[model samples]
Target chain A: MAERAQRKIPDSSRRSERSRRAIHEAALALIGEVGYAKTTIEGIAARAGVGKQTIYRWWPSKAAVLLEAFLDLTGEAAGAGEVGGEGESESEAYAIPDTGDLEADLKLVLRATVDQMNDPRFDVPSRALAAEGIVNLELGTEFVRKLLEPQLQLYVRRLTAAQATEAGGVRRGVDPRIALELLVGPVTHRWMLRTAPLTHEYTDAVVEYALYGLAPRP
Target chain B: MAERAQRKIPDSSRRSERSRRAIHEAALALIGEVGYAKTTIEGIAARAGVGKQTIYRWWPSKAAVLLEAFLDLTGEAAGAGEVGGEGESESEAYAIPDTGDLEADLKLVLRATVDQMNDPRFDVPSRALAAEGIVNLELGTEFVRKLLEPQLQLYVRRLTAAQATEAGGVRRGVDPRIALELLVGPVTHRWMLRTAPLTHEYTDAVVEYALYGLAPRP
Candidate 1:
């Protein structure tokens, strides 16, 4: 088996890249199937058809492996949003678009989030990880810090830009961090709890309710 | 064991009540320790020191048992809010207070919710069930319909009244159902994710941002 693997990839750089991708795929699939608690380095390496040392060489821990795997998954979605040629930076593509209409921009982004959350490939694995996170405080904090918070930070950036925009900006005093949570928190609550249909209409209502005061407009 | 239980309660009614309470407590404890999937009818009965038939006689399934158990736990918190001299209805106790000042009323209730969520007895068992619910759609849906939605409906009732009230009410077009999610959702998200400290100050800020438009007040 080792000889076959080595023969199939004569170039070490290409061989390493192949092993990394396989490990990520194996990690995601295993975590989704058996759950985070049961998924292990040996299992992942066996599934990926690589030595356990290969996984260890790339990641210090299982959590780190899963973290990078999720990042890679989200990165694919981000990369797809790029209109620029292949050479464009990854970060710019993942940004919440500044369409100059803050409300519209937010609604658009949230709608896409609804779509992503609904997709089984994303939703199933995410639910598994999120479920584990809920019970395991250390894992939960790491999931938030590594995966969820970075995505949230995008909203923070967009909202902050809206604050400085010439027109249709948020009020000066509103904390972008907390304000961003208003958009994210509600959608997440519904999604996680399975309380309501996560439709575009629902997300739009959230955006509208959030932007305009719930109280009567004076 | 049965004879001793009967001797402890000469009245069958009192005996049944004791058994029911034990079953509920056992279900909660088991679910907290072993989680929803691993928790079973036979296990609950063994832990509660009751016959399997006794649990099934009271609850149709393990899910039903756990649901009632959680309701019982939260019901204690709800019951404590009552001030009447013993004749008050249970539903009345759970209602969000309508003090004519919408902001104050919301903040008060949300603060109470924060307190409930932080309690280890409530928090630990709740997190376990919630974690299970995240991955288990059937349980998640059942949990929402039976427990969460009813609690949320209190917000709906309050918001609907606010719309009709002469002072400090919501706007005419705001859908109370959707509007209530903004309040419940963010707090739930913070509690479940442990993204930040779920404090009175945070909830108050949520209430303020939610009531006032995130956009600059025109």
Candidate 2:
């Protein structure tokens, strides 16, 4: 509708899509450069080469714009197969592969996650959002709901499949929701705190430790 | 030296100690209320009813002051035995008790940690520092090194004790540093992200899952 009011382009839909993508990239880049506190919708609009009205028409607030952009960035990484080569669509990008050999499959996905987290593109903007989220309850909840929870659910599905008595990975009574934390939490913590390096070797160890556990296996 | 120059009370040492305590309290309160950016030495001094010079004489920067005050607050909490009844001294406050059963000890301390993290006195200011630390690379590194790593080392010691042939807790060849992450990482993530409620039940579950792991036990 807005495009129709503007000068004619090659294709309205393609033009709209391009503008949408530019906004996402601009929002992420602005936040990463200036930090979340200073990032504004106007700055994003200026960077994206779009009018502020266009952003406002599409998204309600700067946070909405930034968070959606954040998710889209991760989606791009997923499409790049940074997390897994199988991802093609938005929904598909969120899904972890299940090869039935749960350990190998989980390891494969987690290593890819490590690679994604390590990518400066994802890491920079994410740190800005995460830092802001820690202090802002509403934004943090939205972040978890919109961005983090969806990805976690994919782990839930994969783990749930493994819980099948016939397939046999997770124990029957084990809750996938809680189980996913052990797999994901360590990596997230190390990345967030910079307490340790996020290496393939490190992620592989996390997977092994989480699968087998600390207690001596009898 | 400054105390000698000022009006002396019945006991100068007691007066100095009182001023020091007030400064710590003020620093924590100011940061928690106004956030790290707005918080300043003047603000802390004003709230504490001390000379700004006094604060500067003791600490080089507001961050240094705030972090030390944070450690003191936790020390006070440790003295209260919120984590373990055995705590008294500063070092003792950091130590995890060895009741021979590693799981019980870890769970006890973790439950205490959950309690501490939940305490508004600890939680509010911590959220500020944690948020700041996430974006500020130098501050984040100092936070992990000075505050978090010490607590983690206690776990390492406790787990190391368990790894003894006779004690038999954490399996041999399992790195304690990595193992500690599995236990601490989940609780930290949930707390930092505000993704879920921080309850004793949740932490107990974390301790259990971390000990046993995801794969179906043989």
lDDT of 1 at A190: 88
The clash tally of candidate 2 reads 0
List interface RMSDs for the candidates, in order.
Answer: 0.9, 0.9
Model 2's alpha-carbon lDDT is 0.85
For model 2, state the Cα shift of residue B125 in Å. 0.4
**Candidate 1 chain B: worst-modelled 10 consecutive residues by lDDT:** B82-91
- Maximum-TM-score candidate: 2
> Residue A88: error of model 1 in Å?
12
TM of each candidate vs. truth: 0.89, 0.91
Please write out the lDDT profile of model 1 over residues B171-193, one tens digit for every residue.
98898988988898889888999
What is the TM-score (0 to 1) of chain A in model 1? Answer: 0.88
Tens digits of per-residue lDDT for model 2 on B1-218? 88777955478788889999999999989888878888999999999999999999989999899888988987876665535445464554557778788778888888988899999989999998988888889988997888888878888888888898665578888999999999899899999998788888788888888888778788
lDDT of 1 at A98: 79
Pairs with steric clashes in candidate 1:
none
